[model samples]
Target: MLTLYHNDMSVCSQKVRLCLAEKALAHEAKHLNLRAGDQQKPEYLTLNPKGVVPTLVDDDVVVTESVVINEYLDDAYPKHPLKPVDPAERAKMRWWTKQIDDSIFPATGTVSMSVAFHHQYTPEVLDELTRQRGPGYRARFALLQKGTDNPNFSDAIKRLYKMINDMNVALERGPWLTGEMFTLADIAYAPYITRLDHLKFLGFLDKNPRTAAWYERMRSRETYRAALAAQFNPKYLPLMEEKGREAWPRVKALVGLA
Candidate 1:
């Protein structure tokens, strides 16, 4: 009875898909072709003003934003509850979820965006594309220059490190980020962090064995595995594979793909 608007490869959408799958809830999936700008169409825009993927329509109620959707699903189902009863533990889950989103998501986006732009257009053409797209997009487009921008790269790297260290500390608190039990927090963080690790931009965990172990544990879950196996542009695969070629062995070893 739920209709989910999602792109198979989107980390945000994967979050929702993982939650729904874990709950064994059957839902209709309408895959948005983001590359074709389907999300910007009038019909889809009526469902989500922001025109983002992973929009969930439950009966008459509509929910956008992956994190919010995760909470909504957990609250709605309440059978196999993802959030624990303890207020403190729930608070910790929310906190870590925010940390994961704010930190890992952006850095990975920057890296991926950089690669995408380069693959799609020449520098001169890209410059024209940015000009036509406007400042908001231009700023994102400029993420390609992160290496030259010390402040930018430093901030990204610092946030990535903090995300790893924070999770490591959370592990010290207990098995899961919130404490003993696994919850929505793990589901939220797994896709983005695993994608980054798969890309080998995970120096944060490289030196921290605790976080490395935690990374391994998170990827072992069926939900996480299912999410990673979602579809994407086959062309992008070889590029991601080639770009992260050096990381292949380590990534495979970590995820048991080896």
Candidate 2:
């Protein structure tokens, strides 16, 4: 039996869950409340030293990173393959996953923390976060404390633009990122792009119609709906909308969208 330690609302967890659903794999779920700092606990740290969610324990084997876990599942299960057969397309899939981790995830984090995290965090939570993590994480909390954009905000927006345009260009090949079939690349980017839609600064999509179309197609998938509905955190939605509305104009201006 596979056991997964994950947070429902964590985008990374959502990706892994979607992959599991697509492959029809049955697994035990252990939900971690990220807001309550469950992930920073010692036991979880033992499983994943990074103190992150969506750690998959397949018998004795442990997979920590979400993308890697998805890949592992595909290889281990083999009933439903999420990776491409062609070498070039597989390379493209890996590159797309890299963008999800290296660029899109950071941009989503910056934008999300900037807009709403400051509104929800208490002093105690902030203190815990600062104490549990290192200088880098504390620095991010500092920016959130200020209730303003981090210095990375501009860079994140720019990177989002680049990622969107790149997706659009690849999508011209039609139906999916690497080509005809939906692969891990699509599963990887789905949540981050949806985060942008939720934040309401999706001009990137407007400028890139193909990606928008791709998103709609993604929405039609059973796994997409299941992932979103299963993980939609109602507790955060009100604040997300409140602050997102308050910050959208500034965000739009910063990203240079009309």
lDDT value for model 1: 0.71
What would you estimate as the lDDT of candidate 2?
0.83
Cα TM-score of candidate 1: 0.82
- Taking all chains together, each candidate's TM-score versus the true structure is 0.82, 0.94
Error of 2 at 213 (Å): 0.7
Candidate 2 displacement at residue 73 in angstroms: 0.6
User: Tens-digit lDDT track for model 2 on 1-258?
Assistant: 899998776889988988998898999999998888998888889999998988999999999999999999999999988898999889989999997887788777777887776667777887888787755876767775554356777777778778888999999897999899889999988887777777666767878899899999988888888867657888877777787777777766775785
For candidate 1, the per-residue lDDT at 92 reads: 80
Residue-level error in angstroms, candidate 1, position 203:
4.3
RMSD of each: 5.1, 1.6
Tens-digit per-residue lDDT, 88-159, candidate 1: 889988987786566677766655544332354456655655565566865665556442242454455455
The 0-to-1 C-alpha lDDT of every candidate, in the order given, reads: 0.71, 0.83
